[model samples]
Target: MPDTAASKRFTVPIGPQHPALKEPGHFEFTVDGEIVTNAYVRLGYAHRGIEKAAESRNWVQNLYLLERVCGICSHIHGFAYSLAVERLANIEAPPRAQAIRVIVAELERIHSHLLWMGVSAHEAGFDTLFMYSWRDRETIMDVLEGLTGNRVNYSANVLGGVKFDVTPTQADIIRKGLTFLEERTKHYLDVIMHDTMFLQRTRGIGVMTRSQAEVMGALGPTARASNVQRDLRVEAPYAAYKDFPVQMVLDTRGDLEARFEVRINELFESYRLINQILDNLPEGELNVRVPRRIPAGEMIVRLEAPRGEVFYFIKSNGTDKLERLKVRTPTICNMTSVVRLSVGHQLADVPMILAGIDPCFSCNDRTVQIRQADGGAQPNGLSSLMSWEELRQYAIRKYEAR
Candidate 1:
């Protein structure tokens, strides 16, 4: 007989406070020797009940509240929320305000992608790339601060329209920044595609085919990397995207390398869109008077965030306060995919795999806990994860019923 004890399975918990994850998330990975057999995620540690809290605040106040959902993608949260509210009120923002919204949104995307690049490079032990990327990222941060008087939460988008306008002087500064960013982005594309050391870690790792990505409900660059071609800006064209169109970025490789390429390519497109919007820079009112109380209605708004597609469900009961506000962030949708991809990979690859999806535990834990199948606590349910098949059916039924 063989010594089965030597090959026994064990569990590794990477925590609520680990060196790998900066946020408060606990993960348990079951491993057979060095290979991961299964993985589960728990995220209540950072839960703030933000969805429920949105019910207590009025529509105007909730704009700032939702902006706190994700510091990196703060503008998108407010943008989606405002769009839903505007739809419920049966109104549209002015052309110039809509145009300004798109400019701020694109700038936020550029900063977010650069931030993720630096952090992911740091995880792969490429501190040189990390530092360089972050240093270059500051140029955009300066432009954001100059435009909105704040860097993180620009608060440029109000309920009816944008709160500020881009001056000719400011546009000149932005043009210079975009020129630098375009050149730096090209270098990053070259490095990620050709660098042998970076390729060794990302290539052929965390591979998800286009079908697998679609079935798993992946979104953003993760889906684009697999050639899913599901960008809301391109497909739906919200805000000023109709005026200044976006060119969708797709990669058929369906690997981590493809993800890097997609995002870097997206930066180029964002740079192009920003310059066009600035050049055209419409002239109109900054905002119109929006009613305090919204009409009784409900609407769903989806926008492509830096990480993935962020879905917002807003319901109004003819009041100043929302009757119900449901936010299905991209991290929650992508978390299951991350756990699924972790299986069969080496233990050392877990960090890279998590980073590859750009997991935002802070955004994922905005509301509830991961419930068990038997309606019990998840601590005793190791295999009770919501599978890709289940999520797919749920989405299908959701849209079909709608």
Candidate 2:
């Protein structure tokens, strides 16, 4: 890394703690007269040792822990984890259970898209769009709570199946809620496409070519906006997606506007999928019994999350506890695109570019690997973890020096 004090380039730091940031992350933008020349991000503030923590807990308990990975997309995390565990145990969830899981997952997609819409609008300084989008988002949240008895972190998944079933009355309520949300979603989409002021903030700015997005390893609607055909739901169907297939939303123009369109159109896709599942809703037992101990095996499960593909790898040791578990979230992939895309753009556009990825640093910060500011790895990455005494002493030394 060049010495910034000696160099002509000015550095701007956006924090590990900042009001503008929704999550904990440190980003540095090297700017030249208000135009960003280069950028980079450092994550780890939210690391909770979830992978290591899962090893000590039983299979059932791990489900609860993993679901808390992201409150916005909790169902997908549990859905992926449960599918992996069930596959390892050689037990398949009933058809009805698979359909119910899909219903919840689609509802989550709706919830996530709306929440993202509002956040991005706020970043663009369009508070009216932000306010109206969030107000309409409550319908989806209400529907989810109605079906699962909770809004966020709906613990819908179990080892062999789901914890709850969608009854007729609940299905009708969902249909009505989605009906209202669908109409609102169409209006929001029209506003994003036609509103001149919002377009000024979104239209040709933060433009990423399809190849650029692919080379940067972008995921979810971020990649889809660039016309990348990379949705795991269609490429590799999981759960009941095989029965009620999804239409992948795509856009040729890879800009902020395209990102908004892809996600807004995806809301329509989710509504269609949910209605299909509910109409042809399968009938069967929600769960099946499994042994207290899982058979020794290794399994990798992948599902299309609201953001992108959620990958989970689980290893069983023929005991109730897992031998190892690893999760690779989509945000980690899409974050790379943000840093690369920020270059050559106005510094003022940085906030919207960051929001463009729909980043969830909390979900991505499962582990920490220390590295120098120059981006070289430490001698032993994991070896840098300090013990309780060392951590306490280190804090005291820093405080005393300050």
Candidate 3:
């Protein structure tokens, strides 16, 4: 017999050259006419095996290697790994070094969010907004360049502490740039909220409930947009977050509009936190001496990367090199939510929904088959064939049985 499920739904393949964000992820959207019935994702187009590579490099060399994991949130990778190593060695970075790390990390956040805003806008065909957002983002990039001497992959971290200190002049420069960024951010927020064209593409699209977010392991603004309250910065407070606490920004709408609002609002919160750190800058050494070879231990470190929580598990055998280094980036955790949410929405709206997650395909370049059944669709293949409730229950049962 002809496969009824295959006949009822046709698959739409979205890229190794993706339509959304120009990323290297392959998404198969099974649609019945215009409405999407199911979605599946296949990654690994850009995986460089950074985790396995970290095992071969020494403690100092690993910092540089892991920093290349994501060009946008490079510093956070280094920051998280260094924290794990320091924890294993039972060493702490000085107050000054910790403060500087926070500064760069926050700056990286602003840079990443701005870039996301632009790309998401472009995906929705708001090219003018895209251009303006990217133009403003350059300000953060310039500040990062001045501070770290490289815009991307800033190797500002070392084993025990930071590689550099924030000088008074550099502090003034960062403050001035941030002040300008703050003003521009307000304008962008207002535009996104009020622009009818942009609103049409974003609002009410990709709706995810708080329960769904938790069940699917959504994190960062993706979860916060649904009012999930799962920020590592606010909840866990690693690095300097404890000293300069984050003011969580949330929305209960659980739609694309909420995601856009949460991220834009976070830019302001990040600005506030960065200023707080600068004003009460700590005094101490740039770096403490960490032993060339770390003591034997295993530790997990989590940090709020631009997308969400970046998890690093480090294992050492009392050697200069690590035994194993495992990295679970935010993109992988959030990909489940993206594929799940894409169902029952219009196929035209797929790009906006995909962009809403601010997906970093490169960071999540691992193969995953989220559903063992034929896609997320029922055999009959109308979107209503299987309700989200049924789908959720099926997922729960499948995983629990495992």
TM-score of each: 0.89, 0.89, 0.89
| C-alpha RMSD values across all candidates | 10.9, 7.7, 13.2
lDDT of 2: 0.89
Candidate lDDT scores, in order, read: 0.89, 0.89, 0.88
- Residue 129 accuracy (lDDT) in model 2: 91
Local lDDT at 99 for model 2: 96
**Which TM-score value belongs to model 3?**
0.89
Clashes of each: 0, 0, 0
User: Candidate 1 on 178-273: residue-level lDDT in tens?
Assistant: 999899999999999999999999999999988889999998999999999899999999989998889999999988899889999999999999
- Lowest summed lDDT across 10 adjacent residues in model 1 is found at 367-376
Q: Write the per-residue lDDT of candidate 2 for residues 339-390, one digit (tens) a residue.
A: 8989999999999988888888878997333322333345654334455576
Q: Candidate 1, 336: how far from true, in Å?
A: 1.3
TM-score for candidate 1, please give it: 0.89
Per-residue lDDT over 36-83 for candidate 3, one digit per residue giving the tens place of the 0 to 100 score: 998998888888877777788799898888888887889999999999
Question: Model 3, stretches more than 4 Å misplaced?
Answer: 1-5, 366-402
